[model samples]
Target chain A: MTSILASAEELTGGVCCGASVAVPREASGCAMEAVRALVRRRVRDLTLIAVPQAGFQADLLIGAGCVRQVEAAAVTLGEHGSAPRFRAAVSAGTVEIRDSTCPAIHAGLQAAEKGVPFMPMRGILGSDLALHRDDWHTIENPYGENDPILLLPAITPDVSLFHAPRADREGNVWVGVNRELLTMAHASRETLVTVEAISDESLTSDVRLAAGTIPSLYVSAIAEAPRGAAPVGLPGYYDEDTSHLRRYAELAQTEEGFDRYLAEQVIAAPAPA
Target chain B: MSEAYRPEELLMSVVAGLLEGARHVAVGAISPIPAGGALLARERAAGRMRVSILGSERHTFFTDGGRELFDCAAQGRIDAFFLDGAQIDGSANINLVGIGSYPRSRVRFAGSFGSAYLYFLVPRVILVAHEHSRRTLVDRVDFVSAPGTSPPGVYRPGGPVALVTDRCVFGFDRAAGRFSLSSAHPGQSVGAIRDKTGFEFTLDDAVATTAVPGAAALALLRGSVREALQEAYPEFAEHVLGQAA
Candidate 1:
């Protein structure tokens, strides 16, 4: 049930299921392209939860003319009808990015990492900001103080696509201390590792990486893409594109505008908008 | 006597009017003046006033013994805000996008981080500006970073309780949310504020700027802010002058 490769063979097949899996080593150069290929092929669905970062940088997606629509469930905007002039959207034209930080997936990953059922959080208890989102809210606590803390059901992505710094033949990978990355990697059904460089030795060979934020067992396919977070982040070497950030911030100002952005950036356009 | 005031004097004076009665306020991401003013208010007012600085970056090292102020808004603790606008029209529609037409505009500002979100929710929002020019005081913002109006009864509706600028002070008509000139800084003419804005204003009789900082208040502001910033960001002392303790 795995599409991992022995050489440059890319894991291009859709999600697979199995008790044990073996993915391609990072020596393969098709990791990022495979994830992008999946998106280009329109494979992943809403049920597939993405992480805090890693995957398409939302801003770049907006500028690329791929967004399609926006669905805003847990955000601050339009109490009555359509969203106002400013507010993140539910479905941008090409893809849909949740309005705020995905504390749910993060918390869930944390819980998963800690081997727990749920994580409690504050701030969503009193408001009906995101209506159909019971998956993120828990109104029960005997003490009932932080009652509305999100349960953050474990993320368990259909596939976890992440860019790392390096990897070895056995699929051991190394990356910067990407805050929520381990959460996404651990909680996903499958893990796709995209590294910046491939080391001849197993990643476990590096003492720094041995501390184990992302244990090797969690990854499936490890491909090398040199600069996966390019134009967005390159940890230690460069900073994110600030102007790109400003542009995304500008587009995310309104529901309609954000939707237009999704269409323009994420979607392959029924025809590129 | 008021006629002798210069621009910077008018600025401090105008700021006083905007902050006159506020007890709790919020300042959100990416604004330097509003962020700085909210800090100034808390320092100057002490425990009598509470100001929450919300930077979208959600991290802070303060200027006055203050904890890093980040993620306060996400937690829903903010009460009021000091909002800034790039292009403010008569109705106070703020435009941060750019000047003129979309593709061919003059100045394009970083759009709102969450002004609209906070505007609708925060009990009071005070629009602060250092640049009170016609270009800035427009009739409407090129874009509505946040709306000035809110619905009745809902907690997050209604907007912009007050608008403060270097030229004058404005308050909204509770019902209309339109900006009304409540007071003018020393030497500022109603005509001047009106000329700067795109809409006509509900002007009140001339009022002098808030009195100059008393010797004690001035010394306290300088000392406390300096101490706070220094302690809050021990490393930035060189950048902040001797403000660090």
Candidate 2:
């Protein structure tokens, strides 16, 4: 049965229709529509990997009980305020938190992309974050005496998920200046993307766009969801729905408020058929 | 008599002074004061200084997402940056992760972000915290997001240069691995700073009063920088600078 499923065309259809996956930042380019769909579908116990920082997406997932653990630099609502759901989860000891720094997460993902065991970074020597993370270890530089550095293990997520401006017919995505999305796709076992539009021409056809494009070989799935990163901005295309985000920030301050928000904004909305 | 300025505005002026010679300065998430300061510095430099503010399309130049900022810092492209913590000790160690033991226990902040890495990479790191009390300035940080100083053999180009608060300013001496009383803000005395600060530090003979932002600097802040800040930090611009988000 698995042998019959070996075609490239079938891969996108299979991968894009899944439940749990890693996602990009909620404040910026994320698969918000897919995240909404996942919430509506009642996906549970999913582990999400965020890009350095996240915002409403993390809060919403936590409020909906869709996440089991999260790995990221920070989960903040930015100018809006504290991420109410994340703060509540931490205080309640409900969710498993793997607190990480921005570069350490990025280094870890880069290591995974290169199939390296670990990547060494500078400046975390005295940080409590270094002390807490068992996977991160201190090692003396072979070249320099008495110099110690922090080495972080690779982070290969189960799925790389995001919202992009466009994907060509061949499935290659043009992410523009958001290149970390490329690294996420490269390091993850599977890539699921929601695009604002499907380009009529192949992304690789233009040499200029080709440099910014992620080849379909790394993308396991692609879904056409216009304004897929809504409420958060997509680079080069849209701005964050600031009022909506502020409203979420305000209403999500309490558990009841969060649940009410989830019920109305996410759960109550029907998944696209 | 000259018009008085807000405590935050005074702090921003001091921060701008610190950022004066920096060619490239980057401001991370939730840092409106530092962002404003950087913008002020840029304005002072007549747009000569490059300010890359995170979450702003107009300000930042990174095309490769968050990692690009870190990568650029590693290559010595960025000269200045800002970091704040839930707790900061005398040695300049920052704690952004939480209050208690890791994987469990107490309060948690929005994680470390890139402090650990950037603290080593960027040349000038200005530590900013609005509250100057014992809770914020601790004897020892529960967690170290980034150590102020590292061993000699380790390659480090960046660390805390100074700390600006509502009450005063403290200059970090890397050699002494301690903070020295630089100056106190208007209406704030050295004794008041001593009472507020949790960590012990060396004091100068006479603490100078923090320089107030002149009419020109104040004008630029309220006019251009405040308006520019609205793009990335709407609430901060509106609430802190009296501009609408």
Q: Which parts of model 1 are misplaced by more than 4 Å?
A: A1-273, B1-24, B47-76, B95-112, B140-142, B210-223, B226-245
lDDT of each residue in A118-236, candidate 1, tens digit only: 76643332222233345665555656453333455554445566566666776766654443455556666677766666667655766866654366687777655555544344545
The most accurate candidate by TM-score is 2
Model 1 chain B: lowest-lDDT 10 consecutive positions: B61-70
lDDT (CA) per prediction: 0.47, 0.81
Q: Retained native contacts per candidate, as fractions? A: 0.00, 0.78
Give the interface-residue alpha carbon RMSD of model 2. 1.8
Q: B8-35, model 1: which lDDT tens digit per residue?
A: 3334334544665566665543343454
Q: Quick one: best DockQ, which candidate?
A: 2
